[model samples]
Target: MLTLNQIKNNPEELIKKLSVRNKDFSQLIHDAIKTDNKRKEIQSSLDATLEQSNKIAKSIGQLFKEGKQAEAGKAKSEAAELKEKAKELTAKLNDAKAELQTILFEIPNIPHPSVPAGKTDADNAEIRAGGTIPKLSKKVPHWELADTYDLIDFELGNKITGAGFPVYKGKGAKLQRALIAFFLDEADKAGFTEIMPPLVINEASGFGTGQLPDKEGQMYQVTEDKLFLIPTAEVPVTNLYRDVILKEDDFPIKMTAYSSCFRREAGSYGKDVRGLNRLHQFDKVEIVQIQHPDKSYETLDEMVAYVESLVQKLELPYRIVRLCGGDLGFTSALTYDFEVYSAGQDKWLEVSSVSNFETFQANRLKLRFKKVGEKQTQPAHTLNGSALALPRIVAALLENNYTEEGIKIPEVLQKFTNFDLIN
Candidate 1:
């Protein structure tokens, strides 16, 4: 969430930045300022009443001390009236604060200046691409390959847990484990501390990472416990620092985690969601960073490069694209998506997204850093990316690496899988 100072300093400028998201926020801005003013008024009135009441009580004590009972009684009555007024004002102030918070929640983060103005992914600008798209002798998608090799039991998964939940068997399960281990080892080599975060999170955790209220409809909720199944490791991993104040030296904090992510993926269908293209449950390795504001963009570049390296190691053909304003996530100021060419599907599949939130999430989390020798603290920038998500990466790998003999494993992962090919 944006801070009050940020909204007040240059509301017009903020409105212009937000307009790139293709919505009018002039009214929300106006309402925030207006509500803040009302809150201030109520606070002032409450303060004055409390002060006056204190003085009356002191004078009433003096009156009684002087043996003047009638004047003391009158003063007490006046004090009671002031107390009631203060109570009313206090309630109004609380209401105003709540109203202001609700308005702020409705407003999405302001897009970074580099964000291209566009309506969809089609409008996103390509940054760069790499690797060669393999010319397969047999262009078989992962699902068909899964059946041919008895690797994944889609029907068994459907019978047990419905569609979108796949049961990996034999080499398919080994491949999943190998990828997770390979990604984690690479992240560890990249100076990221590995953390095993909870698979479920509370409401505050969701809000801390800018997921709740905004994406609640797309999350699996445990209504009885008021907990939500984390849509990504990013949520619990990032929320670990909620309400924490770090020293300046804590800048460039990097952490990584491999978790089983769950998402409702509601209303998704068609060929796009087929097989391993999209899933309700999947494995992913997420990298999160909390960096000083001045160096966050640099860190974002590093993170993007790091993700690029992972796909490269997997021997997958990949491209990077800068998300346009309308396609950007609600909390991200700028984002870069990584897509791998799926030879079988004859299309590109998104395998990762690296983003810089630029204090948007920090403000909500109260995650701040204190400057050396300074009394004040300020919000730090938050960033996270999928070093690599398994399903699509698997989709691309299985499709692109298909051979007449067997599905060839990339050399980098062969050590983990303990074999070179899955036949």
Candidate 2:
């Protein structure tokens, strides 16, 4: 959520930057300013009414002491009327504030200046790529390999939980755990403190990370408890600092979490959602950071590079793309996507998205920081990235590393999996 000061101070510049997202928010901005003005007016009137009522009450005491009964009675009547008027004005102020908040909620974060202006993922600009795509003689998709090796039981999972929930067995489960451990270890090496957040979060937690109201439909809801199943560890991990005020010394706060994320993934179908490509429940290692707004972009670059290293270690062919405005997440000002080439699928599968939200989530979370000597506080920048999402990474690994003998595990993960190959 954008701050009122941002909207009030640079309406034109904000609108211009937001245009990169290809949506017009001019009217929404206008409505917010208008509603805020009305709210201020109501507040002023309420204050004046209370002040006048106080003066009348004070003078009424003097009047009664002076034996001016008629004048004191009239003053009491006037005070009562002012109190009623103040109540009406307070209600109007509350209504105006709600209206203003609604308008602000509808408006998305402004796109960063580097954000490309385009309509879809096709329009995204490729930044850099590493590793070579493997030319596998045997191109067995992960699902087939999972079946041939008896690693995953798709039908059993379907019978138990329905589609999009595959049961990993034997080495399949081991590989999943190995990847989670590997990613967490790498994140710890990168200076992120580990956290184990709740799998379900309350509405405030969802809103703190800009997941609620906009992406409510994509999240699994525990309606009875008014909680939501986290779509990513990013939600709970980032929300850890909600409504917190930090000192300047806390310039960069980095945290990591591995969680079983649950998403509705509503309306997904076709081959795209097959096997390990897409799932309702999946494991992921997430990295989150809270940093000073001034250095956030630099931090974003570091985060991107860190994610790139993870894929490189996995020995997967990967590319990084700068998301165009249309493809950008609602809360992200700038985002970089990491995709790995799956030999069997013969397509790049998105494995991670590193984004800098640039105080958008902070404003919503009321996450702020004060300088060493300054009294005023400012919103802190928030960022999070999938250090690695396991499903697609596993898909790409199995598909690209398949041999007649077995699927060769990356040497880096061999120590964790305790085996060099899954035959």
Candidate 3:
């Protein structure tokens, strides 16, 4: 949520920047300003009326004390009328403020100046790519390799729960666990405190993370309990600082968590749901940061580099792309997506996304920090990234590392998996 002052002071400039994200603001901005102006007018009127009423009441009391009964009665009548006017104006002020807030919530954050104006992922700029694509002796899709090795049971998972929820067996399950631990370990080494947040969150938590009002359909809602299954550890981990006011020393709070993410993947149909491409439930290790506004962009770059290192250590062929305006997430001002090469599919599969949300979420969450030696509270910048998501990474690994004998595990993960190969 943008501050009314920001909108009022530079409406045109802000709207122009937001246009890069294809947001139209002519009407919404104007309406919000009008509502805010009305609210101020009503408040001023109410304040003046209340002040006059208080003065009249004071005069009435003095008159009564001085034995001027008639004068006191007249003053009392005037005060009553002033009080009634104040009440009416107060109601109008409340309504106007509510209208203003509604409009403000509808407006999105302005895109960062560096964001490219484009319509789709195809228009995204490739900033950097790392590692090398492996040469394959035989093309084998991840799902086929999983079956040949009896590692993952998709059919049984479908009968037990539903599609998009495969059951990992033997080496498959071990590899998944290894990835989670490896990612978390890397994040910890990078100054992120490891956290284990709740998998279920309330409505307020969802809105705090900017998941409600727009992506509600993409979450699993527990209607009876009024809770929603977390779509990512980001929701709960980032919400940890919601409504908090911290000292300057707490400017950049880094945290990471490993959680089983749940999503409805609604409207996704056909073969796109095949194998590990899309899933209703999957594991991910997430990294979140609450930083001072000035240092947020730097933190974002560092996070991207960190995730890139992890991907490179796994020896997976991957590339980093800067998301174009239209392809950016709603809460993020800037984003970089990491896509790993899948040999069998002969395409890049998105395995993680690192984004800088700036103060967009902090405003909604009321997450603030007191400036050094100052009494004012300022919103902190919030950022989150998937250190890595397991499903697609698993898919990429299986397809890219498949051999005639078995699938060779990455050297970094050998210690964690207790084996050099999954045969």
Candidate 4:
């Protein structure tokens, strides 16, 4: 929800930037401007009618005081007509504003200048890569390792829920807990205040994070309660500051939360949908930050560095890629995806995505920060990233660390997992 002022100031520039997403935004921009104009006109009519009606009421009082009952009655009738017109104008104004908002809702955020002009993930530019690709003699995939070592059960998950819901057993469940704890501890060490957000959120919470109306189909909804299962901890954690005004000193506000994320992931299939690769329910540790606009990009770099460090600590071979326009998330201006080399799958699996949504999500959330001596509050830049998501990270760890004895746990996670191997 871009502000009216933003749209009025060179909206064409915004539309042109969206060309990288490969869509035409001309008609949407036109409809928004037209609807705004109609709203302004209706608002003017309402104001004029209200003013005229007030004047007539004053005239009616004067006429009555001067012993002219017929004249007062005429004034009252005129006031009634004006009141009806004002009501009609008010309704029109509401309708017009609604129309304008509907159009705005359909428009995605404009990409940052650095966003590469591309159509898919394959077009994304690689930033940097780290660690050595393991040369394992056994080319066993993660699912096979899961079965051989009693880590996860897909059939039991299918029996209880359906496909795409995996049941982690024994050390498998312990590994999930360990990764969540490890990620949380790492984020907490990085000056992020930990928060435990709700698993179910209302429509406003979803929309505040740009998950509603657009991604409604990809979420599990509780129809009776009118709540949606949070697709990520990002939704609830970020929405906590919705409609809040922060002081200038709160520039680098950092918070982290670990939550069980749920996603419908409707219509996804193929070789990519196997095991922990894609899931209806998964665990994740999310980091969110609200920063001053002037320093947001710097903060984004710090977040990316922090996630990179975590991946390094896990001793996983990883690469960083700047998401191209088409592959970018709807609300993010820029995003860097961290993918771990899964030797088992013989491919890189995305374990984290760090993004900077400068003013785009803030406008929707009404989140603003007031300058020390300024009267007006300005929208602050919002940022978030998966310090690490468990499923794929778990997949990569198991696959890359496989040994004849058992799946060897990384030394960093051994303390958390309470054992070195998952046999």
Counting clashing residue pairs in each candidate, in order, gives 0, 0, 0, 0
**Candidate 4 local distance difference test against the native:** 0.92
Q: In candidate 3, which residue pairs clash?
A: none
lDDT of 2 at 293: 91
Q: Give candidate 1's error at residue 83 in angstroms.
A: 2.0
**lDDT: the better of candidates 2 and 4:** 2
lDDT of 4 by residue, 325-412 (tens): 8899888999999999999889999999999999999999999999999999899999999988899999999999998888899999
Give the true-structure RMSD of model 1: 1.8
Residues 1-423, model 1: lDDT tens digits = 888888999999999999888788999998999999998889888899999999999999899999999999999999999999988998999999999999989888889999999999999999999999999878999999989988888899899998989999999999999999999999999999999999999999999998887789889999999999999999999999999999999888999999999999999999988999889999999999999999999999999999999989898999999999889988899999999999998999999999999999999999999999999999999999998899998888888999998999999999999989888
Clashes in model 4: which pairs?
none
Give lDDT for model 1: 0.93
Off by over 4 Å in 1: 54-73
Worst 10 residues of 2 by lDDT: 10-19
**Estimated TM-score per prediction?**
0.96, 0.96, 0.93, 0.96
